[model samples]
Every structure is written in C-alpha cells, then in structure tokens.
Target: MSTTDVLVVGAGPAGLACAATVLEHSDLSVVVLDAGHGPGGQYWRQPAPASGPGALDGAELADLHHDRGTFVELVRRVEQGRAEGRLEIRSEQHVWSVVPDGERYAAHTVDRSGGPGREAGSTTRARAVLVATGAYDRALPFPGWDLPGVMTVGGLQALLKAGGVRAGQRVAIGGTGPFLLPVAAGLARRGSTIVGVYEANRPGGWLREGRAVVRNPAKLGEGAGYAATMLRHRVPVRTGRMIVSAHGTDRVEAVTVARLDRAGHPVPGSEQRVAVDAVGVGWGFTPQLDLAVTLGVDLTTDLAGTPVVGVDDLQRTSRPRVYAAGEVCGVGGAALAVAEGRLAAAGIVADLSAHGMPGASVARDRREVARLRAFADAILRAHPVPAGWADRLEDDTILCRCEEVRCATVRSAIDELGATDARQVKQLTRTGMGWCQGRVCGYAAALLSSGRPGPAVERLISAPVPLGALAAQPTSEPHVE
Candidate 1:
C-alpha cells in the first residue's frame, strides 16, 4: 500500500497546479494518479515523447494565447517537479473506487486495459482527496452521427495534438462555442483542406457578452490569431448555422447544414449539403463527475446549465476534506482552473493547520478566481445549446451508441413500459448499460427517459471492478474520515 498527504484523482492543469502549490506551501507527501501516461490532461496534452511535440504549428491554446511559451517548456515544469521528488505520479492508473478509511481515504484503480486486466490494482491511502477529473465533449444524437467519420471536437484535436495525424483530408468543424475556432486552426495547420466552420450561435449573441474580450486582451488576440489562420486558409466560417445530419455509405462523406432561427430551430429551405470527408461536432462541454458524484459531493449547475461540483471559496466540497477544482467545479478555461487549483491548495493548508492561516494572500486569489469565473460565465452566456434540439433527432437516431439504443426505443420505454424515470429506462432498454458506463449517453439517456436533463447516475465503482478484488475486501464498512 502507498500512502500520501493528499491523493489527487487527475493530472490535468488543475491537478498539477494543486500538487505544485501544496508542495511549495506545506510539508506534505502528494500522490497524483491519472489515466493518462503523462501530465497535462487534455487541454495541455503533449505529443508522445518519441514524437516530441509532433508537427503542431503552435503550442496548445493556453500557451499560445496566455502562457506565452512552447508546450515543451510548460510540460517540462511538471516533469522537472516530479524529478525533484516533491510528489509521486502514477500514470496509466484509472481510479474506479475510493473508500473512506480511518482518518484517511483508500483509492482503487485498474490499468484501463480491457479484458481481465484487473490484476488487483494497488491501493493508495491519503488524508485528503482532491478530484479534478476535468470534462468531456457534449454529444447530442443526430442522424448519421453513428457513422464512422463523425467525431467530437476534443477527439479530433487529440488526434492532431497527441499523434500528429490529421483526422481527415477535409473536415468541417461544427459546434456552438469558441472551442471550435482552435480546433479548426489546428486542422488547418495540419494541412487538412479548409472547408467550413459551422457555428450554431451567431456574433450577435457574443455582442451581449460583457468584458470577456475587453478585460482579457490575450483572449481577444487568440481569437484574432485563429481568424487570421482561417483567412489564410480560405476557410469560411458560417455563423448561426448547425449540422443537422451527416451522410455517407461507410464513413462521413458530407454534412447537411442549416441556418437556425433565433430560437435555435433550423430555418426551413435554408439547408445546404456541404461536401466533406469528416465532420467534427460539439455542442459544448460536460464536466466528468463520475468519481466525485459517487462519493456524494454536492452538485450544482453552471451558467451553461450543465451540472458541476459545488465548492466553497477554498474549493471544499460538502464532503469533508474532499476538494474539487477546474471543470469539475464548472467548465471554465484552463487559466481559471489553474487559479482554483492553487486556491484549493491554500484551503487545504488552512484547514489542516493548527491555527488557520490569516492575512496569507487569500483575498488576492479569491479576486482572481472571481474575475476568471466572470469571463467564463460570459462565454457560457454567449453560446448555449439550441432549444428543442432533441426534437430534431430522428426517431431512428441511436442515442446510446454502446447499446445501440435508439430515440424511438427510449420513448417506447416511457410510453409502453410505463417508465417515469431514467433508471427505469435503463432497466427496460439498456440505454446507459454499455462499456462506456454511461459517460457518452448518460445525459441524453436520462433526458430522453425522464423529460428532464440531469447528472450522471451515481455508482460506487466508476469503472469495472474485478470479483477477486471484491472478495478479498472486508465485509464491514470503513469509517468515514
């Protein structure tokens, strides 16, 4: 068994910042566990060491616009911290369960390798737990989305950033938020033929956002950079437009685009069929709260109406000694995440100390967090998921890809099965029972099932746990720390 002062459940920007700050502020042993092989999570992801930054024309969006450094140097800071023996990092470990032990917590994880790879994952005990599990691309079912060439915005960017592979010869980036801009720029840099960037929200919507551009010149400059890249590549950015459907025999061959009304419904006779080899679609982001939700952390919603972990000023959750940062708190940008991480670390010190640290630069961190959150709130207000989008889904459209459950099937569960809730639909139609464990279809499945959008269902085990691991454990429940 391994032990530490804190067990951080992710290695993203927020997690890394928390670890670094804790190391600097206190004399505590820290263990950072991640499913990834390296640091940087998804936002600051780096190419494999063998590839060494790959062919990316520029650094990540964070370093490009805000940090102002090469990606290599940014990753080097954390790599160097690990080398100095300040913290322990166990990569490729997918945490599935965390149980409260006497005055500490015990976390169990699998190797993330499929098949019977459970091999009794090693246990780590810590006095405090910090969950910064990050977020995932929000996916809504549409006709032909199950086709081979349709991908998420983050998935396409990962392909380019981590493997240096252009997702397709020509691709259309369709989404409702600013993230689509960077994804399009990355694709253009990788030599993909520029087609069209379809945005469901219009510029008039952004005009209502206050100070996100004026307060942050770096953000404005970044937007300008992406605009210049699009101009150079001769790519047209279509506003107030959305991809209603994808068409192909084997893979994505073309996308059917349409201009939406102010209410986000497709305008009649305004549809156009655009030719493209692949389509990258994203509505926005969903916080990955499987681990925290299972642990009973309090839940709240963000400005975008997606659920997030509610945290105190110091990032403390309702559960004692369990802190949450980054997108798990809300889907803010990386800069906000880094600030919250550092603030959460300070909270840890004050709570753990015999005397609460006072006049200790707490007010400054709070102000910064507030400023960043305001900017983030503006971004969310500017781009929102179109209303009645679920109505556009074809009856035959598969909402649950893992189980192949269709929209009609979900409605059938409600009508025929007399199901009034998501859990009933899951039992009736297997909407969220596949290998993904409902990460992909949890929100959609619940919404279609109950006519209300909600958070992912809680499970003691976030990932698959082995029977042997279960058999060896004691029958008595461990004391809550």
Candidate 2:
C-alpha cells in the first residue's frame, strides 16, 4: 500500500486543480486516483488509443466543448511531479470506500479490470482526502424510456468526449438546464439531424432570473453562443414542452412531445408525435456523494433537489481533516468547480502552514473563489427544477431501471410495505441494487418513497456500496501435485 499527504479522488477539474495547487507550494506528496483512463473526468474525456472519432456517439460530440487544454496541462503537471517522485497518479482505479483512522484515512480501490482483468490492485492511505467525484445526470424515466436508443444528455456527451461518437443520425435533445442547448447544437454540428429541442421551462421562466445572468456576463455570453448555434441549425427550440413518452419497437423511433401548463403538467391536445431515431433527455444533475456521505459528512439539499456535502467558506466539511469541492458540493459547472478546487487547496495549505510552510496566497485565492461562487449561485437560482416534476411520471413506468423497479413497486414499498426509508424500499423492492449502485436511481427512489426530506431524508436513504469492491479477486490456485 502507498501513502500520500493529500489524495484527490477524481481526475475532473476540481480534483486536478487541487492536486496541482498543493504540489505548487508544499513538499507534501499528492496522489490522484480515478477510474477513467485519462485525466479528464466525464467532461474533458479523451478517447483511448484503440478508440476512434467514428466510434463517438451524440453524447461524445457534446463533450468536445470541454476545455481539453486545461486537463492536458494538469496531466502534464502530474507527470512532472511523478518524475520528481512527488506525485502518484493512479489511473483506472475505482475507489470503493474511504474510512478514517485517527488523523489519516484508508481508501480502498480495485483495478480497472474490475478484479477480473490482469492487473495489480491495491489500497492506499492518505493524511487528507479531497472528494472531487463529479455529479451524475439524473435519469427520470418516462413511458418507453427503457427503450434502447434513449439516453441522458451527459451520457451522450461522455460518448463523444471519450470516443468521438454521436448517438444517431437523427436525434432529439430534450431537457431542462443550460446543459441541453450546447449539447443539442454540438450534436447538430456533427451531422446529427436534431429533430427538436424540448424544454420544460418557457423563455419567460429565464426572465425571472435575468438579474442573475446579468451579474455574470460570461455566462450570459456562453448561453447566447449556444442559442445562436441552435438558431443557426434551425433546430426549432420548443420551450414549456417535454417528452411525455418515447415510442418504438426495438429502439426509439418516435417521441410524443407535449406542451406543459404553468405548473409543468401536460396539457390536453398539446401532444405531438415526432419521428426520431434517438432522444437524449435529462432533468439535471445530482451530486455523486457516496464517498462523502459514506464518510459521514453533513449533507444538505441544494436548489436542484440534490444532496451536496455541506462545506464552510474554507470548503471544510463537518468532519475534521475532510474537504470537498466541485460537483460533490453542488452541480456548479467546471469553471466554478475549478474555482472551488483552488480555494479548497489553499485552505488545506493554510491548515498545514502552522508547520512553517507558507500557505497558498490567501487573498488572491479568496478573490477567485468569491467571483466564481457568485456565478454559481446565479446559475443555480436560474435553473431550479420545475415544480411537480414527478407528475410527469406514470405509475407503471420504471423509476429505477438498474433493478427493474417500477414506480408502482416503489409506491407499494412505501405505501403498502411500511418502508419508511430508501434503504428499506430498496431491500423490499430492489430499487437501487443495480449496476450503478443507486447512483442513477437513488434520488428518484428517495423522492418517490418519501417527501424527500432534508437531513431526515439522508437518514432514510442507504446508498449502495461502491461496486468496484465486488470485482472477482484473483486467488492462488490449488497445486495439482
């Protein structure tokens, strides 16, 4: 087992920024552990050598907008540190659990081969841990959502960023948030015939948050650029509408789009069927907080209806010696993530400075954090989840696809089976025991099973253990003597 002064648990912007900053000032060693083969998280993903641009799907194309240069430089810095024997970058490693022991912590991880591949796997210990595991695109299932061609907006972006692929020749990008516009336009630019853009909120909804956007001119300009691209492609942006259902025999061949009322409920006679090969849909992001929550960090509900690790101005959590940044704190975009990461590193440095090491330039880093946080707040307030979103779901429809648990089963688990918490519901109905280990289905399960209470909700929920632990362990075979 190896040990380091600080261990950053993700290769995303937040993790990398923290690692780079720590390496800049102190003799304290830093190590980065990530499951991705490359430095980029889902956003700045790069293709494997065997993977080609043609292999990219619609989702992959959308990830191209990520600032690859920043990630590249991070990898370069890590490599330099490695050459100097000051950094250890463990790629394709999936961390299972992080348990605190005294002033240090132990992190368990398996090799990328998921235990079956021919690789050495081991665990490591660190003095302090930085959780930068980014958020996941929430999967809200509708009728026919289980069809093969349906995917989340983030999934499409991952395919493109990692493999230079697109989802299909004809595709529809439908969802809420500023993420979809760029995703749709990116896919369209890559030769995909985007059928329509369906958004649950109307244009006027954004007007309510105009002051927020005005405060962040760069964000405004970014949105304007995405809008301009969609306009150029004539993609027919439909606001206040949502995909009620996707219809197809083998794969998604058509979708039923409907205009919603002010309450975001479907309006009668407003439904229209549009033929399409694929539909990329998502409501928004939810923090990937299994590690943070598992470590007993205090979790709070954000405006996006997700649980994020609560942190102070220094990014320190309720747990001493633990810090969080990036989407783990909330679903702020990469710029905000980078800003938080830098501030977190500075904070760590300051805490370590009592030993005579000069910490990160405090005044400068605070200014950077303040600027980015203002922008993040603006973005969050502008994109609050529409009310009564669960109203769009049908009872028989699947809510947790990982375990084939339907909404009806979830309702039964709560209403009939006396299941008061997400764990009990999952135990009774297998709602969150899927491949993703409840990352995809946990939020929906909690909300459907209960009213999704705040700190109380956390008590009711039992997040799945990281699946990386269950990989087949290689053992010494018996000698046939």
| lDDT, model 2, position 274 | 93
**Stretches of model 1 off by over 4 angstroms after superposition:** 48-84, 112-120, 354-360, 415-421, 449-452, 466-481
Candidate 1 vs. true structure, TM-score: 0.90
Q: Model 2 lDDT vs. the true structure?
A: 0.75
Clashes of each: 0, 16
Q: Of the candidates shown, which would achieve the greatest lDDT relative to the real structure?
A: 1
Whole-model Cα lDDT of every candidate shown, in order: 0.79, 0.75
Q: What value does the lDDT take at residue 439 in candidate 2?
A: 65
Model 1 alpha-carbon miss at residue 393, Å:
2.1
Model 2, range 1-481, lDDT digits (tens) per residue? Answer: 7778888899888998888878876777888998777676776766653546445343344345556567778778778888999998877787766777557777767666433444444667788889898988976678889999899998887765666578888888887878888778878887888999898887775666666566668787887888888888888888888888989998999999888888778888988999998889987887777788768888887764557888887678888778999988877788778777877787677676444224345556566666666666655665545555667677888888877888888888888888877788878998777776676777667766666622322321222234434443223221211
